[model samples]
Target: MELNQIYNNAREKMKGYCKVCPFCDGKACRGEVPGMGGAGTGSAFQANIEAWQRYKLEMRTIHQVQNPSTELELFGVKLTTPIIKAPVTGSSYNMGGSLSEEEYADIVVEGSKEFGTIAMTGDGADPTMYNSGLEAIKQADGFGIAIIKPRSQKEIIKRIKEAEKVGALAVGVDIDGAGLITMALKGQPVGPKSKEEIEELVNSTDLPFILKGIMTLDEARIAAEAGVDAIVVSNHGGRVLDSTPGTADVLAEIVSEVGGRIKILVDGGIRSGVDVLKALALGANGVLVARPLIIGVFGGEKEGFKMILEKMTTELKKAMILTGCESLGAVKGNILRKLND
Candidate 1:
């Protein structure tokens, strides 16, 4: 089916929760908690899109680079593209219950593997949400990453052990989930961690341990000092707080402070392969595509998801070629021209 058809199908299935807007921006669904909108004023969500749009690319066609490589290696796993499907849950309530948690995780894990990249599964207030992702990872022979919520220390450690058992490539905690009221509503409390607490958690996992949702250079440094294998510079898709700066707005500063020390992945309002190029130029090792994949999976299942990834990868390759980047390593901040510059 065409992408538009898939989107229509998803909109029909998801109904009130998500309108499945064409742009997937926060405009139509602002303040939509149970659906795909941002939190509070939705400014944070909008900021993500605006921040990326603020920068323009400088094209250079006078190059002999015939082929541009989009290959990326993360945590010892080789991926065709430096893009990973972000860990997302809430298929039940937030997504209108059209797709079960397990079904969604299965599509993402299998689809990502088929596309030569890995998917990150998410944790939710419900225990089954995480378990389903683990099962999917097991089915994928542990080619997935399971991101846990910032639960109690005991709970986080318990999930880490489970992730190891499933042979997950890496595991992490989206510390930004600490502000999610749904966790408390479900009786699973979550909160920010002290540096000591973060260090202890990192030490508990033998596998690569990532810390997601870091938006500030200070926190990025703390994560690096705490020995996290990587960090996802995210604003929790603007779902956790209002008026927070977009991930792109603060990514350069964070990367400057902790770039070589930690693998930096970014997400939030990344809708296209061109956006992915912008992210790489700004020093992100990888980018996460969230809402678009949600549309893909909900609309067309595994094939739908794969189609979106492949399209984005193709677009990224084209962007690289036009910008004289022969490989992902060659993409630099110079490729982007700020308005003032």
Candidate 2:
């Protein structure tokens, strides 16, 4: 099954929750909460796509490179490509109840493994949402990452122990979720963490601990100071806050502040390998794809997901070769042309 076929099937299956627009831009479903659109005016969501579009790639073909490597080792885990499956939850409410939480996790973990990468599973308002993801991770021999919400210290620590039991590759807290109304509505207490609170959680995990939802240089520095192994430069896909800057717009600033101090990953409007190239050039060590993968899982399950990954990897390699980047290491800021520049 092709991506288009998968998309069509997903659209039919996920009608109300997600239109599964041809572009997947925020335009079609703006301000749609408990669904696919961004929060508020959806400007934050639209910003992500627009920011990436503004950056042009500089292509150069005159180089002695027979092959280019898309391979990367993130936090000691070998990956075929730098593309990862971003954590997602709430299949019923947010994704149209087409697939159960467990079913979604299964496709994400298994498909990522097949593609030589890892999937990051998410936590949600309901406890079962997290448990199902943990089960899928265990099934995949812990070839996955579990991202917890920014719950209270006790709750977050408790979940970390669970992730440890499952032997997850890493654990993360999307602090951006602190403002999610869904969590509050469900009576699941969640909020932002203090520096001490963040340090405590990082200290509690032997596994690499990541702090997602970092959109500012200060927060990036704080995560680095808190000793997080990595930070996902994200605006919670514009779901948590309205009118926030696109992650891409602020990624370079964050990286400049804490680049080598911590590994940096990013996700937002990243729909293709070209976008992946742009992210790396802007200083991301790796990148994640959410909406497209949702389509892949819903439409084609594991094979469909695998197909999308392979296609992106191929596109990344092509971008690398044409830009004279022989390895992932060679993909640097110079390869991108800023809109202002």
Q: State each model's CA lDDT, in order.
A: 0.92, 0.91
**Model 1 agreement with the true structure over 271-333: per-residue lDDT tens digits:** 999999999999999999998888888899988889889888988999999999999999999
The TM-score, computed over Cα atoms with residue i paired to residue i, of candidate 1 is 0.98
- Among these predictions, the greatest lDDT belongs to 1
lDDT comparing candidate 1 with the true structure: 0.92
Relative to the true structure, candidate 2 reaches a TM of: 0.98
**RMSD (CA, angstroms), candidate 1:** 1.0
lDDT of 2 by residue, 57-171 (tens): 9989888866898889987878999999999999998888878999999989988988899999999989889999999999999999999999888888999999999999999
Candidate 1 lowest-lDDT run of ten: 332-341
Residue 191 local lDDT, model 1: 95
Compute the lDDT for candidate 2.
Answer: 0.91
